[model samples]
Target: MSHLLELFRFCPVCGSEKFVENNKQSKRCNSCGFINYINPKAAVVAIITNSEGDILVCKRAKDPARGTLDMPGGFTDLNETAEEAVIREVKEETGLTVTATRYLFSLPNTYKYSGLNVPTMDLFFECDVQEISNLTARDDVAEAWFMPRKEIDPEHFGLASIRKGISRIVGK
Candidate 1:
């Protein structure tokens, strides 16, 4: 009951008030012996760059880091591969289609959504775009622009995972 998920008071299966901590990551319904696990979510990020190697960046229009710099990407849908998710999210948010991918690295991030701290495994990929003239800002993006390699300061990005990724890119 001391967990942050204090709103989870009753058993989901039998409406019993006997749900107890089974482990660090799960709760158990003592009545039905049903256990629910809180697992880290899967997310993807597109590290897209133009012909001059200027990275594509987005300004967030939503909370958690509104107006801060970000890359083109989002959480993966159920049963979606990381590759597919990168393609879909980039198209939805940046209007750019991904033609190729170069795996970069993975980082663990804590995404604050709706006051709940959600743990996520963020998969970063360097995406290839055939055309850049057709790209535009949409979805949760306030604006989209290309940042030159020298100007891509990690401190400008609000997400810790993104900062780490950029630091790695800049050999920090």
Candidate 2:
């Protein structure tokens, strides 16, 4: 939350040079009286399990946790539902189509990117892949693989929300 205030020097609504912080949640424009609130972004997190109960994981290729373990999901685009976002992200990163999904949970997380702490609400879903075999990593993923649930280690995940989500998903 502190990151949002620090990044904005002027009011976005009125372009006024004078902007005042009303609280940790919002900023007020002195010129136009436009109030801006810091809202967490919506992101989808996949908990893909195979017939053998192994979990699909992606090796991140970007920062804020590059080279670390992540699920096959990403931020939602405009006008896309959470379910649609998960399906699209899964296909984009893993080259697998999502046949179905079940909502599991949501976790709040902070992603630091380019010197900004981006707040995100990670909406988790148990995604069903049409074909587990012959999967390839793409987009921001460098590699993709599956591991037994028993061998899953949340500590290996780079994001705090991912760690917690893995723990909850694997019953650890």
Candidate 3:
């Protein structure tokens, strides 16, 4: 979030935060003629399904959709493969060990947060849980559960990627 960056006065070009917004989009460093362009972050998540054909969803513990249900996924780490990120996110959020079967689809969505454009390229994967027990929420997740596709409320879901993933899987 840009607000998080505002706490610093170092120029991004020279680690100096003495900068000001030129108009409404670009930032200019007073010390140096350095201009930094803000960009969006990418996040990856899984649409995990059990043998019973129920899709896994977690209650978000953070904003953008706090308390809303979403698939177990988040920002992809540096140097981490999409598959690795999905598997790790699923386990971290739901406490369920899973193996990624395949990538479902990639969705690009944008939302505003902290006065900055938060755009995300959400990479969705279809995964199968190895063992369903020992479930507890972690990684900014309040709760996790499996729900039949037909029973999921669209309005309660955090993003369209989640809804689209469920629709695609259940339709097959």
Candidate 4:
């Protein structure tokens, strides 16, 4: 895995090549005394279930893990709350307008993107959508469907945190 510190050849604040590792989690610009912390990005995961107790699942249309089972979610945008992000992500990926969300739990994950292993804190939420009648896959989802909780196999989910979450929810 490529270290995030290695990616920073220059300091953002001073545009100096003196940016070096300040510690395990940050890079410091010796020229201007600017330190950039390598913090995990915040992401939201929506666990939506149908009235019949089937779980909503999406097929990833893009890689990191394309053609695999996933939940509707994405990284939170700047200046947005986690709740808002979940609602937005659900709509963008599943065409479902989330009416309510209850925070569940969070897990650490390593998302490989652009040849870099980006760390993320994935927050899980139990979301209620307005309706599933119009649940068409959109955005980065190739397809979306609901499976009975008993039929869900955690191993089918490519992401580690998601697999764990599904296991916990299904008691599998």
Give the distance in Å from residue 71's predicted Cα in candidate 4 to where it truly belongs.
0.4
Please give the ranking of all candidate structures by TM-score, highest first, separated by commas: 2, 4, 1, 3
Clashes (N, CA, C under 3 Å) per candidate:
0, 0, 7, 0
The digit string of per-residue lDDT tens for model 2 on 1-172 reads 2547677879987799778887876788889998888889899999988889999988999987999999889899999999999999999998999999999999999888778788899999998878988689999999999999999899999999999999998888
- For model 2, the stretches where C-alpha displacement exceeds 4 angstroms are 1-3
Q: Candidate 2's C-alpha lDDT?
A: 0.90
- lDDT at 161, model 4: 91
How far out, in Å, is residue 95 in model 3?
A: 1.4
Q: What is the C-alpha lDDT profile of model 3 across 18-129, one tens digit per residue?
A: 7877544457788888876556567887776667778777888988778988878888799988888878887888788885458767777765577545667878777887
How far does residue 94 in candidate 2 sit from its true spot (Å)? 0.6
TM-score of each: 0.93, 0.96, 0.75, 0.95
Please give, for residues 1-172, the per-residue lDDT of candidate 4 as tens digits. 4457687799999899999888877899999999999899999999999989999999999997899999999999999999999999999999999999999999999899886778899999999999999999999999999999999999999899999988988899
Runs of candidate 3 with Cα error greater than 4 angstroms are 1-11, 14-35, 111-115, 160-172
Mark the regions of model 1 whose C-alpha exceeds 4 Å error after superposition: 1-4
lDDT of 1 by residue, 10-125 (tens): 88889889998888777899899988777889999999888888889999988788889888888999999999999999999989989998889999998988867787899999
lDDT of candidates 1 onward, in order: 0.88, 0.90, 0.74, 0.93
> How accurate locally is residue 50 in candidate 3, as Cα lDDT from 0 to 100?
65
> Clash pairs of candidate 4?
none
